[model samples]
Target: MPAMTEPKLISGNSNRPLAQQIARRMSLHRGMSVSLVDARVERFNDQEVFVEVYENVRGEDMFIVQSTSNPANDNLMELLIIADALKRSSASRITAVIPYFGYARQDRRTKARTPISAKLVANMITQAGIDRVLTLDLHATQIQGFFDMPVDNLYAAPVFALDVQHHFKGRLQDVTVVSPDVGGVARARELAKRIGCALAIVDKRREKPGEVAEMTVIGEVTGKTCIIVDDICDTAGTLCKAASVLMDAGATEVHSYITHGVLSAPAVERITKSVMKSLVITDSIQPTEAVKAAPNIRVVPTAPMFAQAILNTWSGTSVSSLFDVDTLTPIYEGLYHRG
Candidate 1:
């Protein structure tokens, strides 16, 4: 196996703090040698997008850190331009490290006329000259197959599991893991198995994008402390509604654990008024000011995990075991259920 060279970290305008955190984990600051030129990215009078990258990236193993979160178009364009710049400047390799990959929910088309936006995004990235991709908790695991190049889908479950263990040490006997919807059963099941707790599912009906009606619980949540788990919490509609349902089902307390916090449009207020005790989210997407100010929202940093993955990848070691569920099962089981 070839030893990986020191990677050059570059940041677009998407999430500077996260890029800084990842750099800190790697024990290196952002490279000062390459200049990141901020070009005015706006549509013409007719409303068309344009981009430019003013930096040189010749012969560098460049990594562009950008999260396609809110204001997805602008951030996506910035990433594409930066990758193009690196490719044109003859960079040895360009890796796109996207903590939050937007449009991931569209991995497959539900309706006949709808497009597979996730595949489209993959095409765009590949065409933009990105040699590889590293993203966290993609909505659909199969989205990775959409890409032609190597894709590393890192898990935030270990981070969440560790935090859960730390917070509820001896009181895990009454805990129950929950999936906010049927689509997320796999994720919640993994967490439940790790924590050694019984699992529950929330069956919901979506009226529209930001509207949800939680119907019922699939498993035993009655009298149990419920932790609703999901990949992304955008409007907080599904989470809040599911929590309400759980509480009405005699759940002692309702909490939420989500991977990406894309808390958009009135989500803060919704969570504030909801019955949830707290909503724990990873720092995949940079939290908005509203999210930062929300009292019920708490953030868990993924710096250590990302750092470990980067080191392992660079060292030609297997990163698959970083958070093996089987290895951590005993720890989580003891913390959550076994006492």
Candidate 2:
């Protein structure tokens, strides 16, 4: 087979630190050189987004690193405009590397007269001329079908498992993975299986988005190190409540491993004052100053995993193995080398 075109990384304003980290890891690849594209994504006086590519990317494979997080509309627009700009510049292929896809929680309608914003966002990306998508842990896995192009949805379980192993080095048998709600049992089960620990669920009566009326521990958590696993932690009302409930149920310690820390509003304060031992989150969303200053919060790097996935997609290698628990150790150990 002929050699594929060199891949170029580009970044929007959403999460430049993470983009730089991914680019740095890619550039460290043994026999290949990958670099970020020199591009300017600016705004007009009326707050309209504008993009200008300085490099001559006539036939390059482009990957735009943008997380549609806090300013969801602005970051999303920047991605779409960047994709359109790259398409107009004659790039061979464009892949959107969205670490945190916004509107994902709205994958379906829960009430009367509401739009499925997740599907709408997917359609917008398809219409914006992106050829493919590379994202991590969609709120609803079914959202992948909303796009017309190929979508690579990566999981963070392997990364979390490694952290869990390191955090509770001697007490693996005393750990229990707890899902904040029944809906997240599968996620918690996968993590527990990876760590060879027991599984538990918190049956919560959710009153609203961030509010939980009551919670009951469904399994034995007494004297165990409880680790709450969930995707998005917005206002954190539910997480805080769940942690207290677990502790009340005789859990020795409570820690959380949430993927996207959408720590909005009083989330930081709530988590800081809660009984949870610590909250470990990924850098899927750029951590705010408050999130950084919080005493009990820790952010993990996803750049190594993301860089590998990007390289695999460009080289047409299997990406599913990246999430395999056994393969992740080597994948993280040798990220700068070709697989």
Misplaced by over 4 Å in model 1 are: 1-4, 28-56, 325-339
Instruction: Give per-model TM-scores.
Output: 0.88, 0.96
Per-residue lDDT tens digits of candidate 2, residues 91-172? 9999999999999999999999999999999999999999999999899999999988899999988899988887788889
Query: Model 2: residues >4 Å from true position, as ranges?
Result: 31-33, 334-339
Clashes of 2: 0
Give, for candidate 2, the lowest lDDT window spanning 10 residues.
Answer: 330-339
Q: How well is each residue in 1-339 modelled by candidate 1, as lDDT tens digits?
A: 665456667787678888777776566322233222333444568645555545555676777878999789888988898788778879888889899999999988787999999999999999999998988999999999999998999887876777787787776889999998888999998888877888999888877666774478899988899998899988877788889999999999999999999888778999999999999998889888888888989998865566556656656677777677454444334333422
Query: Cα-based RMSD of the predictions, in order?
Result: 4.4, 2.5
